[model samples]
Target: MPDLFHPQMMGYLESLVPQRHEVMLEMEARAREIGFPIIGIAGGQFLYQIARMMKATRIFELGSGYGYSTAWFARAVRENGGGVVHHVVWDEKLSSQAKDYLGRLGYSDIVQFHVAEAVETLKATEERFDLIFNDIDKVGYPASIPVIKERLRPGGVLLVDNMFLHGSIFDPANTSEAVQAIRTTTKLLTQDPQFISSLIPIRDGIMLSYYVP
Candidate 1:
């Protein structure tokens, strides 16, 4: 499979995003340094836009890494008259790092940190969310769908990252567990009667699904 995005095009898209907070910039740098995969500038901006457009007050993020995407959601939640954004990741060290970064960003009140398996944590949570963002390990994507659907309120939105798997999804020969899971998850979302879905070709690909039921 070829690259889904040209280098220059991705750079242009990133450049269009307005300046982020210093903490966010630092987090981006850290991701780059550590080869950590936080959603890039364009993806983060898009997430913020979706949350703002929907006026999503309550957001739950699966696989929040050092709170980069969580910051974006927390910002929108704060602007939408203050709400909560749950940040869940299995790594305690990453969760601690996220807490420090979000605390510095002054989103400590709006963001809740959790160190546990993201899907289980979301399933255990009692409050229905207005928006749910999933960026967990691709192999887990299919299994996570049922829980995500149950957790989201009617008319809520689900934003899923890495839908393209860097264009491997288009290659018939590529049938790894992660790729297969992505395909199955895509099928589940797009073919389901309860949701209207579109795959947006952002940095990687983000599936934006609106739940109608």
Candidate 2:
């Protein structure tokens, strides 16, 4: 993807973030080494701040990867007087890695891991959540909205990542299914009366939607 933010600006923003735990730093290093995508410092810190600000206790993440983002939410939940964060990803190995990492981070008590299709797991889950974070494949974005709406309590928040698709969403010629799905999801969140939404251009663009129900 092209530079979403100028290199200097991105570096400046990253430099401003306070130091993180050694484990979290290790997770960042691992992502860089493998070219794996995590939310990065800015996005992870944003999630942490939002969860803390809202005093969210019950959080569900649709595409948690090795618990980098999950650790942030877990920390917030811990400071918010304790609650649960559901970490749902389809990969068993990723889930296992997350279990180990979060356990080392002392968040084993705060997070629940699931190795299943994320949207389907959310739909099957009976309990409503105070916050839901969606970072699943872009093609699944549109279909996941109704399920997210149903699972998130009224006044709860929904954070969807990759809304920019590494700048692909802005290209009219890129009518790929993933891009179109993101477009449709954007319209669903912004145009729907039930949601109050804004696209935050941090990292890859996260769609923050408040479900008014």
Candidate 3:
């Protein structure tokens, strides 16, 4: 991923936050060593703050890679009346690993891991969510907009990662499917009256949409 902030700025920003748990530190190291795309400290902290601000109870994650981002949401949910976080992922091995890490973090009981396609899982579920986090395949972004909007309760939040598509979104000639999907989905959220959206430039980028209806 490109550098979203200068090194000095990031150092200063990181200095302001409290230290993370030992399990989180391990996850961060593992992600770096394995070339995994776990949401880093900035993104995790942003999601944690947003979830807490919304007082999110029932949270759903479209894609959870080793439960790094899910951990942040799990903590917030635990502090806010103790609700559940349903994390959907495709790989069974990754799910198992995430379960173990979350268990170490004392969030195993609050997080339910589903090994399946995220959209399919969302379709099969009857429950609604107070907050929905999207980090699924970029191709699914366009298809996921309506589903996310539908699943989120009124005044709920729909937070998406990788809005910048690694900086390819700004190129008019970059007509790759992933970039196009992100563009279409972002347009859908930005133009829709039911949502108020903002794309914060941190890490790859974060698209936060608040459901008003």
Candidate 4:
């Protein structure tokens, strides 16, 4: 997926950027302390910069873990005078934790936290978005791509985190669902006519795809 830099190099690069929101800072700490590989601060910053650059208004996130990336998306849209971001966090405990953190940052008014399967939430919602983040069970990624692309406004972006899955996709001993999803999604994305895509390897690799129409 990503071949830009090694993980350590990316971490160094992450240190040079401004620190994340307090909530995400805490999440970063927790991710490190508990060995949560899903937390990607640099990857989040990359997405954040894209959102900021696009002046994203309405945003949506699938599988927002403790609101780390969601906070960045919220900040990007909020700085533009209070845009909304619907964050779908599947884990109840984690969702509660994220809500508390977002509330502390006064982003409570803009974030709609959903404690349900992200696909289900996406199916049920009627709102469109300017940006979308996909970070769910990797096996579910390919199936969700069409759903994600449909909801995005023209020129909107869909950012997929953990695109490499710790090199497991290429590891001979690994035969996991996540790996399969990564392969399938990557293949689908690279061949898609509507999207111009690229994979940036920072900590784990992130797939950035845009809708040109």
Q: Could you tell me every candidate's TM-score relative to the true structure?
A: 0.96, 0.96, 0.95, 0.91
| C-alpha lDDT of residue 29 in model 4 | 86
Candidate 4 lDDT tens digits, 32-119: 8998765476677777789899989898888888887877888888887778888887689998988988898878988998989997
lDDT of 3 by residue, 1-213 (tens): 987567577456656768999999999899889989987887889899999998998999999988999999999999897989998899999899999999999998899889999988887889889999999999989998888777889999999999998889989999999999999989998999999999988778899999996
Error of 4 at 152 (Å): 1.5
Structure candidate 3, residue pairs in collision: none
Q: Whole-model lDDT, candidate 4?
A: 0.82
Q: Which ten residues in a row have the lowest lDDT in candidate 3?
A: 7-16
Worst 10 residues of 1 by lDDT: 2-11
TM-score of 2: 0.96
Candidate 3's TM-score reads 0.95
How many residue-pair clashes does candidate 3 contain? 0
Error of 2 at 84 (Å): 0.4
Decreasing TM-score order of the candidates:
2, 1, 3, 4
lDDT per residue as tens, model 1, 1-213 = 987567698789999999999999999999889888888999999999999999999999999988999999999999999999999999999999999999999999999888899999999988899999999999999999999988999999999999999889999999999999999999999999999999998988999999996
Candidate 4: 10-residue stretch with minimal lDDT = 2-11
lDDT accuracy of residue 13 in candidate 3? 63
